[model samples]
Target: MNDEGAVTGRRGTRITSGSGRGLRGAGEAAKNAWRRGTGNRMVRRTGLVATMIVVAVGGIFAGLLVAGDTQADVGPFAARFSLTPSVSGDTDVQIPPLGSLGLDSHDGPAHLTVRLDTLDQDRTFALASDANGLAAASQTAAADLRHGVILLVERSIVAGLLGSLLLSALVFRNWRRVLASLGIAAVTLTATGAAAAITFKPSSIEEPTYNGLLANAPAVIGDARRIADQFSEYRDQLQRMVNNISKVYSTFSSLPVYEASPDTIRVLHVSDLHLNPAAWAVISAVVKQYDIDVVVDTGDINDWGSQLESSFADSIGSLDVPYVYVRGNHDSAVTAAAVAAEPNAVVLDNQSVTVAGLRIAGIGDPRFTPDKEADRKGGSVPEQLNASGSQLAATIAAAGTPVDIALVHDPASAGPLNGTVPLVLAGHRHAREVSFMPPVLERPETRLMVGGSTGGAGLRGLEGEEPTPLEMSVLYLDRTPALQAYDEITVGGSGTAEVTIRRHLAAGDAPGEPASPAPSAPDVESASPDPGTQASPLTSRPGVTTSSPRGN
Candidate 1:
């Protein structure tokens, strides 16, 4: 009986072991099946999500293209504004027959465009005829543009939401996915709009890249530095300028078009504007009137070279020609950077650039004198300037290319550059002076021409007994890149309204020869119109050459 019981126990143990093995095998199989099913479900969900995202993004872009544009009357002009998906953000203003103005307005993946559709001739005529109409119309136009922009935004949002829903419904045939797509569209657009708004630069308007006939428009519209009291006068001046432009355009169309010599390059040299808004008007006027190929500014463009003062350099982009600039004692790196940012500007600091068929080299001043409390480094001012000038001369020598002009802010710095370049321009003395250095050794002769204050010494002019005159020079260069002649333009400051132009011939003396002494008094051709018939800034009398020295 005991043997039989032991055997029974052994059998029971074996049976239990067998059942445990079966249960373990079944559990492993079930786990494997569950993992496969879970993976499949996850993959399906991921695919659906991706499809919904793609559809939403595509629909939003389509909607924006179809419904994001709006047309409205901006004063006397009918204009259309549009928003579209883009890789980068920009604002484009398009005017028919004229060219377009482009601005880097933001850093989002969207672009905005403003197009002038048509003009209301009757409204234009009526507003132009009134003395105060331009100011009033400008205010109305700003309001209308704001309203139109708001409307466009609202419509774009609604359209994008609707478009996402439609696409989601068609693709997934599910209400949940459609709602999800709408949410995603909303989030995307909100984020994009926020980025654009945060990065938008209203000041960019002052630095637009002008193209077409509109390239010359800034001269007519003026800059944005006028005082509130001058608004009326500014408006009046704008009106008169517009009328003058129209007459000129009509005259151009009626008469034979006057074309400048193809082989001749005209350069307008201006310096020491000191942030004077009037200087921009004068520069633009001279550029347009003289058909200038390039503009060379010697320095002192700003008083302090502060970031706030940098915006004044925006006008350099509107000059419709290449603007080559160097730094002065008053200008800092901040000012140089601002000048370099303009689309048409070429900033030279111990560097060289070829512009408008002329190779030019320049160097910035070694001293920063604006901050009186700042520590002085390197050496004394004159010594540092001399070193900088020597460095530039070395750089030009290494280039193995002939530089047509060399620019410096201080005459002291210019001494080391003698015989290095044919023409060296400087502008620190605040007086127009010219001298020719005879060739030494194998070096060629060099002409040093100094320009006066283009802004009439800026606000400092008020402190002087006599107002400083606004001065600039126009240089004519032949295809050989040699100086042919130059005109000295002097405008009376402190409300003098008098303009004088003195022309000088560079062909009077042979190369390497000493320049003759300047006449006791150079002949000046003055233009002073009556108050009732004030000549436009664009108008100037023809320049008459003086019998002064060859290098005058």
Candidate 2:
């Protein structure tokens, strides 16, 4: 019986083991089937994610290419704004007839362009004619630009998402994948936009590269820091510009135009800009109106003569005419180098050059007093200036070519050049003056013409009881390169919007004749006429004032 039981138990154990094997085999089969199902699902999801990424990238680029542009009115300008794929990360402004200005606005594979398409003449006229029109237009334009940018961004994102969804739907014919694509696109766009915002640069506006005619317009924008800090002052400048434009338009339309003889040489004399941006607009307008052949800047073009300040000299390239420059006390070696770098600039430092058919000589100031510090050389400023003038005169004599014009920053430097050069042009006093130095030792009489602050003494003009006048002169010269007549132009600065142009004829003496000794210093009468009235021609009276401050 025990033998039988053992056999039965072994059989039972064998049966149980067989049943357990069967169960294990079934479990393995189910696990394999489950693995196969899970792998297929994972493959599908991986493909969908990859597809979504591809669709998102492709759709964004397509959208940007197709619908990444918008148009809006920017003040009197109709401007088009666009985004393009680029590594330059630049914001470019294109103004037709002028040129382009480029700024490093961000680090990106994207670039922004603002192209000024057309000017609304009617709008311009309205703005120019109305005293408050420019301010109103500026505000409106700012709002319009903001709206346009928002619209552009919105359209770009919507178009991109729609494109992605359409692509996904076409590829998968499934709502889930299409919906998934939208989420992916939104995430991608959000990441890109956040990156761009993080990299955006606002100070880039201060270091713009001006191309074409707009090259000369840099000074008009002035310092970007000032623009940001003193927006009201900037608006006031715009107002002054509009008022000047209106006055110019009205004056030219009604006045009897003086047709200069074809052989006459027209020279525009400017000085003491002191980094005033408004001066560039005035200069450009005057250059165009007078058909100026050459532009002569006496000195003090910048206030600080800093390397950064040297950028103001960039406008010299855009003047479209010969620009003869002399260094003022405020201009340093760095400033001179910057002015020399311009394509059309001629820097005269104890040297002579011929420009616009006239031989010109110039000498830089003997001192640099931007900080109002006395000269470190420990000598009289005037004496040092006279020595510098003597060196210029010697250089001119050595050159053996007759110089028609002599440029100096200070009148003291101009003193020794008297009777040596026929005309000595200078600034630095911040007031206009004209003096006739009678011929001495058989030399011809020298006419000393000092220009006032062309930039209205820049920011310093604001400190006075009254805003200093913006002054410039247009000299009409004969073929002999002799001064025949000149127009002294004064534009009321800052708070005023009046422009006065007085014509003065250089008579009573031939190009080489001796003239009567004029007053040592004559009083300069500030001319403030009705907005658009042209002053009658006046006799050549000396407008020099001895009581004026020495440095600009």
Residue 281 in model 1: shift from native, Å?
A: 0.6
Local distance difference test, each candidate? 0.75, 0.74
**Per-model RMSD to reference:** 14.0, 12.1
Off by over 4 Å in 1: 1-260, 373-375, 493-495, 509-542, 545-552
Worst 10 residues of 2 by lDDT: 543-552
Candidate 2 residue lDDT tens string, 425-538:
999999887777656887788988888999888766655446677899988899987887777777764444555565555773344443332222232233334545642322
- Scored by lDDT, the top model is 1
Q: Can you tell me which runs of candidate 2 are displaced by over 4 Å?
A: 1-238, 246-259, 371-374, 508-552
C-alpha-based local distance difference test score of model 1: 0.75
lDDT of 1 by residue, 375-417 (tens): 2778777788889889999999999999999999998888788
TM-score of 1: 0.51
Where's the lowest-lDDT run of ten residues in candidate 1?
Answer: 246-255
Q: TM-score for model 2? A: 0.51
